[model samples]
Target: MVRSNAYDLPTISVQGEIDHPRLRSLGFVDPSGHAQLVALGTSGIAYDVRIGDRAVGWAADHVEPGVSIRHSDVEANLALAYNSCVGNRAIVVSGRAQGAEGVVTGKHGGALPTDRLLVDFSPDVLDKLVIGDSILIRSRGQGLVLPDHPGVSVRNLDPNLLDRLPISEVGGVLSVGVAARIPARVMGSGIGMGSVALGDYDINLFDAQTVEEFGLDRLRLGDLVHLEDTDNRFGRSYRKGMSTIAVVAHSDSVLAGHGPGVVTLFSGSDEDLVAVDDPAANLADIWRV
Candidate 1:
């Protein structure tokens, strides 16, 4: 069995409020040079979008599924984004939806407007939510380590979720099931970020052929994706024989170099970590959120 230092980790409380969605004053221009003005970024509560929904073809740019939040203070917001792990429990502490429970579904590194955390909630709870509502998350799992597989680094994934992943180790190689494999070359925005725990990079879908070739057009919000020839240990970059595992946290974008946002979950050398295709390999299915 795969083991980690999960039992020894500390789970802290981090608080944030529903963030206000904002669009650029003049809007943005697409790759086709078309200026578009639409709903974009950080909606307090998304009633229709859920974990298993499609990530592409949204009328929005960098759309975050479920509820989005941020701390009013810059430093605190940074902590909220960096510390909260996917699968962490989030509870509403204020507003009409007080006491409502949700799951931390994804995190977006300030790709466009601001950095935010995505939380999935029931439709009834969403109906009662409002902007500025406070949420408290029990944050943990940032420094998770696979003791038997030191080469594989775990980040931004909850220990509980990690325990549930279909992971197996044999002959010095760790195999994980993923919904899809993303080519490293198709990666865009947030590529040069110095840290993976703070935010997620985008999957560039500007090239229709590449998107189709990789079957990315049907990507879902909580899908587990494998990044081929990708490295995120120190920073985001391409290293031969290395791969990274990430979860789709946000929606598709019309902006150049910006598509669905994905937060890193695991990364290691190809020799030590391997991915097996399993169409059912997604957070929505695994976590049952």
Candidate 2:
């Protein structure tokens, strides 16, 4: 397993809650210029549903505001964002859900002032978790490195999660198991970001033809998906002969230029990533989460 040289990274604590931001107009125009009012972003209990649950929905399935934390301390929030990675351990330090543990599933940026970081807790504990609860993160996924593959870049992923992934070195090449293969041309929204460690990108499911062709409708919330012809090293951009492996963070959205969200695990170029199919190719299954 890949481990950081410096094992003394400081554990940082940042608190957030379910934010009920007032919207003058909940109505939004879809990609087809159709009006929609879908409830999304933070709070409420999302049940044991998986991806592809509600292909036609006004809300993001299986992802709600368990706790949202960001403050005027932009630098500090950014640091917390950078330190916390997918699959890291998170404990409810305060509130009724105190001592309960969960996993960091994904992160959202610029969406809300305080709801930047998005985490996932089991349904049983969600009710106990209220807004403004203290969340202590055991942040330790920053210094991960693929010692063998110098070209691939890793971000917002725990090394332990990486180990559980079915990535293997066979015949001097790495094979990554993915639930589905998506085309880079379909990638929309949240691109050109300097770092995915702080946020995630979305796969626009607005095109009916593309969704049917790629089998994206079967994606699960934590499924590991492969995006062909995409490079997210410096920014989310289309690059031929490049591919990125990411985990689905959120559910499908009816909003314009938005769909299921995905955070980058690592990216490789020159056709180094080989896509293989596996039904259990998801974070929840990997760690038995």
Candidate 3:
């Protein structure tokens, strides 16, 4: 994995330029009942059709809630070896079915996907696997960069709340920035859901009622939302000048290779977020005092 300065937020960078004469779409299904083409990351091909600001759920090709398969499901000729692994692809480097392969899957709890890609391994191989084992990933997509926008900022976040954010009932849906113009989707997993506080957010797709009530239908990808920042370490507060902001990027969990939606602390400190009615306000405009 690439590393940056501690103060400099981490981001992905592409190794080479892609100059395909004719690009194709991923034909991904969004949570809002729409079919759209999507980029795996900022480095991949850019799409033409834009979606609304509502948070939509997305996944790497072939990922589901309870579906497990072998790495051969996606790749046919994967080699099995110790530490000769790829980043997001899955390979059965060791065990009874030592040669079997799986998708790189993702990282959460104590287990992480071999490559940034999801790996599918046979149940037999999975059962014999132990912690500290290595897998492989055939990394794709363009490089990602931590966006540099005043509307977005980051701080030490409460892990518990990150895990508790609601999930969208509709496919590929998530609640994003306050504006209604940005277009982005959610994807992936291991965003510390089920775990709280060590720097995770339970980001989920907002329901229809909340989406309408908050005028979320107007939001677009890349729009920044100034979350009601607060000092309360345990719960949420909606006060003026007491909120932080995050940008709506992909519609995926923060864990694994998927990018997490972010709220930066550019204007205020952790304590600056207080209580208020509009929790997702662009405070930079109203709170600049």
Candidate 4:
């Protein structure tokens, strides 16, 4: 197991809140099948269209009901936001849920207020957790990589999580098993960003017919996805000879150009990329969270 010296990075506890401000989706309908006047502002539940019941969450990417985190130091907050990968452990350090253990199911970030982390716990744990409770994420996997493939750069990933995936070289190609393969062209909102660690990018699932055609509607929270013709080693950009793998971090949005947000996991050039179908390619299934 390739581990990091900072694997035991100081655990930081941040407070949670229901931070939803009034949002206006001018002249558009979200995936919820309605034009809403006011979006729900609360934590612990997702309000939007989702793929499967077994999915860890169904929260929308930008504006949805989920736990929100904020820190005074920008660097520490960014580190907390960037290094923490989905499926990583999150512990409740204070308030009603003190000593409770949970798994990071997803993360949503953009600007102020809407930025938040989504964690899934048992019903009992949820009942115990309250606003302002301390959620501590044991941050790790900041600069992850595939040692064998010097060409690939991994980010926002947990090495233990990566090792769990059954990766193999078949016929001289790196075949990665995923719940589904997404075309790079369909990726929208945050295309020209620098690096995948800072935040997550959304998949554009606006066209209902197109979504059904590509089978993108089957995407579930925590499912790993293979992005076609994309690269994110240095920064997220589109190139013919590039490829990237990311996780489904949040649910579909009503906002015009947003869908399930994906946090990067592995990225490399096309020569080293290959993807195949695996029905059980989800973090929830792999980690049994």
Candidate whose lDDT is highest? 1
- Model 1 lDDT per residue over 1-289, tens place: 6788998899999999898877557576789999887655556678888989899998767778889998878888888888999999999999888999999999986642367889999889999999899999999998888888899988998999887887878887889999999999989988888888887899999998998999999999999899999999988998889999999999888878889989998899998899999888888898676
**Considering only N, C-alpha and C atoms within 3 Å, which residue pairs clash in candidate 4?**
30-254
What overall lDDT goes with each candidate model? 0.88, 0.69, 0.30, 0.65
TM-score of 4: 0.81
> Which regions of candidate 2 fall more than 4 Å away from where they truly are?
1-24, 43-72, 110-115
What does the lDDT come to for candidate 3?
A: 0.30
Give each prediction's root-mean-square deviation over alpha carbons: 1.5, 2.9, 16.6, 4.1
Q: Across residues 102-212, which tens digit of lDDT does each residue of candidate 3 receive?
A: 432121111221211223344455456543343333332112122322222323222222222221212221222344221122212333233211111223333445445
TM-score of each: 0.96, 0.87, 0.30, 0.81
Ranking by TM-score: 1, 2, 4, 3
lDDT of 4 by residue, 44-89 (tens): 4443322233222233334322354545456555656666766567
> Which consecutive 10 residues in model 3 have the weakest lDDT in total?
77-86
Q: Measured by TM-score, how close is model 2 to the native structure?
A: 0.87
Error of 2 at 84 (Å): 0.9
* Per-residue error (Å), model 3, residue 216: 1.8
| Global Cα lDDT for candidate 1 | 0.88
